[model samples]
Target: MAAQSKIPQATAKRLPLYYRFLNNLQVQGKSRVSSKELSEAVKVDSATIRRDFSYFGALGKKGYGYNVEYLLGFFRKTLDQDETTYVALIGVGNLGTAFLHYNFTKNNNTRIEMAFDADPNKVGQEIGGVPVYHIDDLEERINHVQAAILTVPGAEAQTITERLMESGITGILNFTPARITVPEEVRVHHIDLAVELQSLIYFMKHYPLEIE
Candidate 1:
């Protein structure tokens, strides 16, 4: 835990991307890979990749580069891939329904254990193998779930977030436009698709990125 805490947040965020690419390399029967190779595959610069790997001392050799299987095993342990993380969905709208149909556990060890909705028609119905319950049961049924996906309307985001925090939610992936407040210790990742799309378009028009 102490070691993990010391890693830079930016590097920590990139670890999974590196792990995924390494996993693909192993699947393709590739044994050794250079940082330059990884840079191209994952779209990260070679120098940045070297620096990120430096956080964990001696991950690769000076001349021999990296061993695909060895690096894969190392990242599996570092990312706690052995254990599956349970999550709860707090809405049953269009976006939330699509998320249910997607099998996240196929790539990462994260699964939506259940979903909650205010609509009586959605409640008691199962979508994508995940059971949907009434929103009133949030506290009673959310026990043991570590994280949540907040897909409710912007109006209900704060209310649902308060309820989720009360039930011991550690983190939230908030999809609502409203910025819900949370305690200092609680982590929240806000992903507004509209805002992201606009930002992407603006960057492309104003600052064109060079193609590799």
Candidate 2:
């Protein structure tokens, strides 16, 4: 088996999806599951599932399949389900407000512990039980939180990103249209809603699926 660091990033990205489905099976009193069954449930081909599991050694038997409880325990450890990771939200506008109101407690280890915004009216308020602080106080109040959600306007995204990196934030979920720059150690995931919607429409139009 390969070390965790050696696992392909594409395979690692699908780990959470596999974990969630296995969790559901366990709750339904399923004691074991076959690779084919897992493929159907997760929509990944059985061959790809087999290859993904191979990276972590023999997870499932040839005929007996995989033990639900054992697989769940493995995934819990791999995904760090026992420990809680606190995060900060860096905007409080409509999009950011929706994130704060979102319930992230279900099967997730990360929590939004605090928020930041430049608006004086929104400062010192608590939305979804998470406290909001002035953006100027970011470095002072961020504490041990290492990840942040960037929902600030496009113009402010890059400036706030640099500040966040300097203030010890290593990972960012950037929801803004701006393409922020960061050092090699810093990781940023951009989620552009408009572009994604446009891509979906384009794919449906050009690569239409055949019906049975």
Candidate 3:
């Protein structure tokens, strides 16, 4: 694996997509796959897939394409698939509860080991086999967690984010629409569902398909 700093952020983000497709190919008893095949499967352009793979230097041959087993092995090591990443979920609202139940079941490497909620009724209860604790124990319970999923109300996003940072949470997957601020050391990825839906509608309106 190349130094992560050398890979473009966009390309780095697509690695998981490639790894997933390769896993599917392997499961289907496919030994090799071309960039075009991978592109079609992952919905990424072939040229873009080639460039992304180029960052890792000769991941596939010109004619032979990529071996499913080899590519999967490479990505498994690169993505640290064997290692488990413990994540904490904040706020056990509807969205948070859904996350706890689903819990990235396909991705074996990541798991929401525990969750936090402000509602007293939900506290000390277990959902989807994950124990829920009070928000007051955020710092104490999150000591071993590397990342967190923030699904609290927009008003509480910033305050809870600060508490998460104070507890040494370096990465946050924020589902709230608050756009909370964080220091350089902390990384936050926002998943604004409304914004995404709006963008999808915009694309549908402006780039409507042409029926043949």
Candidate 1 residue 80 Cα shift, in angstroms, is 1.5
Q: Specify the poorest-scoring 10-residue window by lDDT in model 2.
A: 1-10
Which residue window of length 10 is worst by lDDT in model 1? 1-10
Instruction: Please give, for residues 1-212, the per-residue lDDT of candidate 1 as tens digits.
Output: 34468789998899889988988787788998999899999999989988888886636787889877777776777787878889999999999999999999866798999999999999999999999999999999999999999999999999999999999998999999999899998999999999999999999999998999
lDDT of 2 by residue, 1-212 (tens): 22457889898889889988998999899999999999999999999998988876647888988888887887777777778888999999999999999988766688999999999999999999999999999999998997999999999999999899889899999999999899999999999998999999999999999999
Q: List the candidates ranked by lDDT, beginning with the highest.
A: 1, 2, 3
lDDT of 1: 0.90
Question: Cα lDDT for residue 87, model 3?
Answer: 96
Q: Judging by TM-score against the true structure, name the best candidate.
A: 1
lDDT of 2 at 101: 95
Superposed Cα deviation of residue 201, candidate 2 (Å): 0.3
Q: What would the per-residue lDDT of candidate 3 be over residues 1-212, giving only the tens digit for each residue?
A: 44457889898899888888888888889999999888888999999998888876646787889878877776787888878889999999999999999948585589999999999999999999999999999888888899999999999999999999899999999999999999999989999999999999999999998999
Question: How far does residue 17 in candidate 3 sit from its true spot (Å)?
Answer: 0.6
Tell me which of candidates 1 and 3 scores higher on lDDT. 1
